[model samples]
Target: MDDAGIYTRESEYLDCYVQLGLASDRVLAVSFPEESDDEDADHALLDRIDAYLEGEREEFDDVAVALTVPTDQREVLETTREVPYGEQVSVERLTRMTPGLDASSDEDHDAVRTALAANPAPLVIPDHRVRDGPSGAPPEIEQRLRALEGL
Candidate 1:
């Protein structure tokens, strides 16, 4: 769910960090490049994130990363369209084409939370369906009912 395009070259790492931070609240710590350094500093920062995630650090999850760059960098971002593996696809394009879960937004987060809370599933039914004409149900029927209830 990273909104940023893939990390290919060396200059786009700060945007990558911002994207990762937005995706995972667990990234409580981030250090950006000094304003004077060459742009290649971004690559180092991205490498750090890769190490953290690969190390089985608990901070990583299916979090969404949104890439944000200064307006001037728009052309550089667009260049990502030529990247292979399709990882460089813009967030807008990805959201429009993917199915199952729709693209997430600030508003949709609340909606998803509300839906999950309201519909904890596994329907409950009375036991009479499996019982004999005027008697209580047997053990096997009760077991089946309990299993369904657990679902």
Candidate 2:
């Protein structure tokens, strides 16, 4: 996580992992598809994550993320970030919520799906809360996250 925010890459090892910026002492990147060790980096965000895993409700809205996708895709991820914890919204609904998207259009639906798949941060963006399309997370991971939210 840099001064601006955390940047993430999808992985296939653990639930989450982060790369630290040596000079800034901030996280440079976070990976959601898999797990990695960040045992030495003590941050409040990590604490919050721990809390989330233990069944405490954590909105994660306060966390900042740096998106490197195109404007259209970025908008989709930004909207996805606002999805409330414990609630799920279908891709159609999510597409509708995003500005300039026409849910009735198949192309729009595809855009939403593409945006979701391109999401760099899954848990932080709460992609799991969006259903009926790719969540930028593994299927099992998505199920686990939803179950944790009691959804």
Candidate 3:
């Protein structure tokens, strides 16, 4: 695993983890291999993170992206579009899980929870597609939630 340094001014950081012989170009262009238990592996990782967070074993403020392999392909692929692996949930929904807050409150804990549960794992999107949108929550939030839930 390699730390890609913080793009803090842009509110982002890149971390790359390499798997043996996993072609970066192919992995980005296609879905995970059908025969590989990648989904289960991903879930297990999420579970571990959740447990660590819930047990207060670690501290985090928002979710961070996980790149399986390091590459210079930060730009979006023009030919290959990404299809989300799971249900699409809006950022609004995730923020609903935070307690003691109204729907309009920006820092509601329920809203944070909603975001965490809705998108439990890091998502893969084209580099060009990534943008600094309206939601300014830091990447550490995901870590905080996992510790809160002790998943």
Candidate 4:
């Protein structure tokens, strides 16, 4: 990137669904379409996504993503990131899977949904792995991610 923070998250991947900033391969952010602007694609980072889409099991394990989510939702996001590459889980299930999460509590449930809706990194974090519940990711992105997972 020409400048660290100056580099926009927008990049030239199909539909520009991914926007990321890397200085010496350390990720600054991987944002959504609305959250990104045109920036150079980190080919190596993109390659891992492509590899996963092409049926490779691993997904973005080596790529670091910088996020600014609230502490209240950190457990949810971290748990979502651990979802198996080709598996799907409902938001309810995610909440239950997360330690000390109470899916039955409306406040906790909303917190989980809100965190997912604002997920900046879709494929990398695989928010689309969420099924039978609201997915905050773009429809196209969610569809594509599901397709890759063979769902």
lDDT of each: 0.28, 0.72, 0.27, 0.68
Cα lDDT tens digits for candidate 2, 20-129: 22224323334542444334345566666667767889987877666778999989998998899999999999999999999998999899999998876677888888
- Those runs of model 3 whose alpha carbons end farther than 4 Å from true positions after fitting are 1-85, 109-151
Report the number of the highest-lDDT candidate.
2
Which of the predicted structures, 1 or 4, would earn the higher lDDT when compared with the native?
Answer: 4
TM-score comparison, 1 vs 2, better candidate: 2
- Candidate 3 achieves a global lDDT of 0.27
- Cα-based lDDT at residue 83, candidate 2: 91
The local lDDT score (0 to 100) that residue 12 gets in candidate 4 is: 33
Of the two candidates 1 and 3, the one with more favorable TM-score, higher being better, is: 3
Q: Can you tell me which runs of candidate 2 are displaced by over 4 Å?
A: 1-29, 32-40
lDDT string, candidate 3, 1-151, tens digits = 4323211111111122212111222221112121332323333223434354234343221323333331211211111013122222333432332233354766543334333322212322211111221221224432323233332
Candidate 4, lDDT over the whole model: 0.68
Q: Over the stretch 1-151, how does candidate 1's per-residue lDDT look in tens digits?
A: 4323222222232222222122232222222222322333244335644453333222222322232433322222222222222022333333333233244663433332232222211011122121121112233433433343231
Better of 1 and 4 by TM-score: 4
Using lDDT as the yardstick, the better of models 3 and 4 is 4
Q: RMSD of model 4, in Å?
A: 3.9
